[model samples]
Target: MDEDTTLLALSAIAHRSRLAIFRLLVAVGPRGLPAKEISAQLGIVPSSLSFHLKDMSRANLVSRSREGTFIYYSAALDAIHGAIDFLTENCLAGAAGNPSSR
Candidate 1:
């Protein structure tokens, strides 16, 4: 990911609720969960979850799809990995035995 995209993804996850949402999604895996289930599981108000989900979608941190009448959301894995890669791209570049590398 480019600097701007990475920044957007990082900023999107910076919020407490958003981070919780992202972590929950990651734990749930790519099959994802319905909007109602997410809100219930996280104890987030439906309206608030909707807003956070929208922001995350804009940042490419999450994706959604409609099936029947429900909207299922999942982490944008490619973007997640990209953002992580951007952060640690050069960590311990030549420190072969660095503990931090592990």
Candidate 2:
């Protein structure tokens, strides 16, 4: 991921409610959860949940689809993995020693 994308994703998930929502969606896998279900499970109001979902979508951290009248939201696994890779791309490159071998 580029710096801007990484920053956006990080910022989107930086909030407590958004983090919780992301975790829940990740746990549920690609099948996802409907908006009502998500709001109910997280104890969040529908309007607040809508705002969080929009933010996450803008950051490309989450995706949504519609089935019938329900809108299901899922964690964007590829984007998430990309962010993780970006964060750890050069991990421990100049450490004092091989910490893993210690």
Candidate 3:
């Protein structure tokens, strides 16, 4: 991912609620979970969860789909991996046997 995208994803996950939400979605797998279920599981209010989901979706860190009356949300694997790579990109920058620097 590019710098801007990485920054957006990081900012989106910087909050405790959002982090928990992301982890919850990841644990749920690609099948995803309905918005109501997510809010209930995370102890978040529906309105707050809606705000969080919107921010995450804007960052491309999460995706949403509608199934009949349910709005399902899923963690975007590529975005998660991109954030991880962004954090570890410079790992062991000056250390030996760091394979990462290679």
Candidate 4:
């Protein structure tokens, strides 16, 4: 992803509620969780969950699909992986061959 997209994603996750929701979705895997189930699991109110999910969706961190009557939210794996890559791209820069730090 581009820098702007990465920043947006990072900004979206900087909030406590959003971070928690993202982490929960990550733990749950691609099958995802319904909004109510997510709220129950995270001890969050439905309205609050809706707010956080909206932010996450804007950042492309989470996606929702209508499965009958329930809207299930899943982490966008590509966005998550891109964020991780952006953060770690320069890890231990200039020390790739250094063994002592290992």
TM-score of each: 0.85, 0.88, 0.86, 0.84
Scored by Cα lDDT, where does model 2 land? 0.89
Candidate that scores best on lDDT: 1
lDDT of 3 by residue, 1-102 (tens): 777888899999999999999999999999899999998898999999999999999998899888999989999989989877876674434657656656
* Selected candidate, larger TM-score, 3 vs 4: 3
Model 1 over residues 1-102: C-alpha lDDT tens digits?
788998999899999999999999999998889989999999999999999999999999999988999989999989879988887774435557677767
Please estimate how well model 1 matches the true structure, expressed as its whole-model Cα lDDT: 0.90
Name the runs in model 4 displaced over 4 angstroms: 90-102
Q: What does candidate 2's lDDT look like per residue over 1-102, in tens digits? A: 887898899899999999999999999999899989999999999999999999999999899899999889999988878778777764434444677633
After superposition, which runs of candidate 3 have C-alpha atoms over 4 Å from their true positions? Answer: 90-102
Give the top-scoring candidate (TM-score): 2
Supply the global lDDT for candidate 4.
Answer: 0.89
Evaluate residue 94 in candidate 1 and report its C-alpha lDDT on the 0 to 100 scale.
50
> Model 4 reaches what TM-score against the true structure?
0.84
- Return the TM-score for candidate 1, rounded to 2 decimals: 0.85
Predicted candidate 4 versus true structure: per-residue lDDT over 1-102, tens digit per residue: 777888989899999989889889999999899999999999999998999999999999999989999999999979978977876674555456788756
> Order the candidates by TM-score, highest first — what do you get?
2, 3, 1, 4
RMSD of each: 3.0, 2.9, 3.2, 2.9
